[model samples]
Each structure stands twice: as C-alpha cells, then as structure tokens.
Target chain A: TQLLEQSPQFLSIQEGENLTVYCNSSSVFSSLQWYRQEPGEGPVLLVTVVTGGEVKKLKRLTFQFGDARKDSSLHITAAQPGDTGLYLCAGGRTNDYKLSFGAGTTVTVRA
Target chain B: GAGVSQSPRYKVAKRGQDVALRCDPISGHVSLFWYQQALGQGPEFLTYFQNEAQLDKSGLPSDRFFAERPEGSVSTLKIQRTQQEDSAVYLCASSLDLGQGVDEQFFGPGTRLTVL
Candidate 1:
C-alpha cells in the first residue's frame, strides 16, 4: 500500500498568519489531490496537482507537486478562522479512482 | 439534492447489531465511492462503483463490511455484527467519471456511526 505522511498533525495560528502543510511519500503517484474537511462534514476538494513539478493556485491557497510525484504541499496565505479544519492529501491515479489519504493536518486559525 | 447526500446523518448501534448507511450521489454522476474515517484520521477508501457495477472493494477491512450500488446512483454500506472498531464517519463521494483524468469528487456530510 502507498502511504502518504502529512506533517504538523496539528497546527494553531493567528489570523493573517501563513502556514504550509506537507504530504510526502516514497512511492510515486500519478496524481495527487488536496482536500479540506470541516467538522461534521466530508472533505471538499481544494485542488488536484497531476503533473510533476506542477503548481496550482486557488485564491489564497497554493499547491505544489514534487518533481518526482512522490510528495505535495499546501500553502495557505493569510489564514482565517474559517480556514480551521482538517486538511488531507490523497495520492492515486486519474483512472483507477482510488485514493490513499494522509493522516491529516488539523489547522486551527484563531482570530 | 445539489450535492452528494447521506441518510441517517448519525447512527448508534449496539455491539453485534447490524447497521446500514445510505448514500445518494449527485444527479448524473457516474462514479461513486465510499470511505471510512476514524476520529482524528483521514478518510480511507472502502469501495468504488461505476454505474451499477462495483469496480473495487480491496480496501474493505473485512468481509463484514459490504457495499453495493444497485441502480448506480444510490449506494448502501452495510456492516454486519458491528463492533466498537466500526465506529467512524462513513463518507460518500461522486464524480463525473473516473475515465476522465483528474475529476473532482464531491462529498456528502457523511453518516457518523457509533457502536457501543
């Protein structure tokens, strides 16, 4: 099984502070997706980085896929209380339709 | 109605009891998936369905966990003789199609099951 290890299992930061969460694995992935889930809710797709060395920006968040496709990262700019939630990274193929998730990073952005 | 929806947002079952959770995927979605999430952990893949066919169930922890998609749109995950270890949030997701590379999956609020 391919395992995704996420760093900073828990994070607490003040509003306006920036934070970066990482997802790493020794196994190569064809595609990697980042998801953010709030309490009592399932995860919502934040971004999907497919190509090696690919970088995608979604408003205040930026996602990067390592050149080897074995790791990825999510950077949040100017965090807010609304950003407090569990952030997860899943690695899998575009067609296989299976996702192996990381342990997750619970971010608490205080006001 | 607009997004993936799950029934019985919460379920409480005594040990050895049987429980069934339901998932209604978004209209027109061709791919559906089930995942189990323990507290403080990320969601783990349980099964995947394409239309009325179950394509993969390799993630099932045991034979006691069974999932099916009869009509392709609605799915059910039935757990027999539930145990405390079965306590977790069951999430359902749907996508346009898995054949399309990198399709975004929309998730439901999920059903939280607690086995006593």
Candidate 2:
C-alpha cells in the first residue's frame, strides 16, 4: 500500500479559480513536504510543514499540516496557468532520510 | 548552484544493456538520494549516500541496480541488464543531513530513462 495518498488524482480549473489538494497517510510523520513539478523536470519543493496543525503560505498557496501529523492539504487561491503541474507530497519519519511519497495530483489551470 | 543537477537529461536503452546515470549534488551537502519515478507515479526511493558512504540501499528494486559516490560529491547509479520495467525518471536530491531530520532535500532535473 502507498504510505501517502493524495486526493483528486487529477484536477482541471480555469485560471483565477481556487482549489485544494489533499495528502493523507496512515503513518505519522516527523515532517511532511509538498512539491510541484513541471513536465520533463523533477519535483520542486513548495513547502515543508513540520509542526502539527502548522500552516504555511507561499504567496497564493496555503499549506496545512494535520494535527495528527498524518495528513496535509494545499490550497491555491487565484490559481494561475503557471500552477498547472503535478503536485506530490512526501513524508520523512523519525530517523529516516528516505522519504515516502504519494502518487501525486496533476493540476491543470486553463486560461 | 542552489540545487542538485543531473547529467544526460534523457536516456534510451535496449533490453540487457547497461546504463549509468550521474548526479551532481549541491556543494557541501551531506545527504544525497536517488529515486525512480514511473510515468504518472511519484518518485520512489532507490538509494542514499551520506558523504562518501552509502548508508541505505534497501529501496533498490533489485541487485541489478548499483550506485556509488566515491568522492562524496558526484554520484552515479548504474543499472545492468536493464529491462523495460526499469524504465523511469531517475532523480537526484541533496540535503544538509539526515541525522536529526532537519534537512530539506533539494532536487534536480531528473533523467528520463526509456528501456525498450
């Protein structure tokens, strides 16, 4: 089974719309990270939320860590075409460097 | 200068062929990782290096896969007798450290490998 699972395997929205992607897991993580990847490239770090219930904002993207440390969510306000890509979530457990990853959410923002 | 870098942005191999993918980590980084990503799937861990030592290789799919970081900087992942199932995007990442779980891994543009 996948250690981390993301919802809405795919999403398509018009530019300027708002949407949220979820990353859920059964195992607790010491730290969780969200990444965005464009085609033909590796995933890029978007945000890393450590503390439970932690919320971080990267411009229009708001990331939240679940209180149980087993889930996370990323909400994009006023999405732009540039935001169209694959969003993946990874988690690092205590004393582990190898992160477990989720399948990913592919987002498409149409103009 | 700010992130990891990989060579041979794309690779195509035939069955039973041998291939080597290289990864140049961010300077001064202590942790290096290798991951394989299949189409439409997330990156899966393959191996890890801390400086010049390989600390974890349990994630490697099989014995046919091998990796080395002889200089503690540039790393190489070599695959022998590659099969079609071995085709995937190989990514490299570097971080400060993995001891206390404080480092954030910076990734590079992965090399997409297609085995026919």
Query: Worst 10-residue stretch by lDDT in candidate 2 chain B?
Result: B96-105
lDDT of 1 by residue, A21-94 (tens): 99999988898999999999999989989999999999999999999999999999999899999999998875
Query: Residue-wise lDDT of candidate 2 within B1-116, one digit each (tens)?
Result: 66788989999999999999999998998899999999999999999998999999998999999999999999999999999999999999998876335468888999999999
Instruction: Highest TM-score: give the candidate number.
Output: 2
Q: Model 2: runs farther than 4 Å from truth?
A: none
Weakest 10 consecutive residues of candidate 1 chain B by summed lDDT:
B96-105
Q: Which stretches of candidate 1 lie over 4 Å from their true place?
A: B99-101
Put down candidate 2 lDDT per residue, A14-100, tens digits, no spaces: 999999999999899999999999998888888888999999999999999999999999999999999999999999877878788
Q: Is model 1 an incorrect, acceptable, medium or high docking prediction?
A: medium
Please report how far candidate 1 places residue A97 from its true position, in Å. 1.1
lDDT per residue for candidate 1 within B1-116, as digits (tens), equals: 69899989999999999999999999999999999999888988898899989988998899999999988789999999999999999999999876343778899999999999
Candidate 2 lands at a TM-score of 0.97
- Each prediction's DockQ against the real complex: 0.66, 0.69
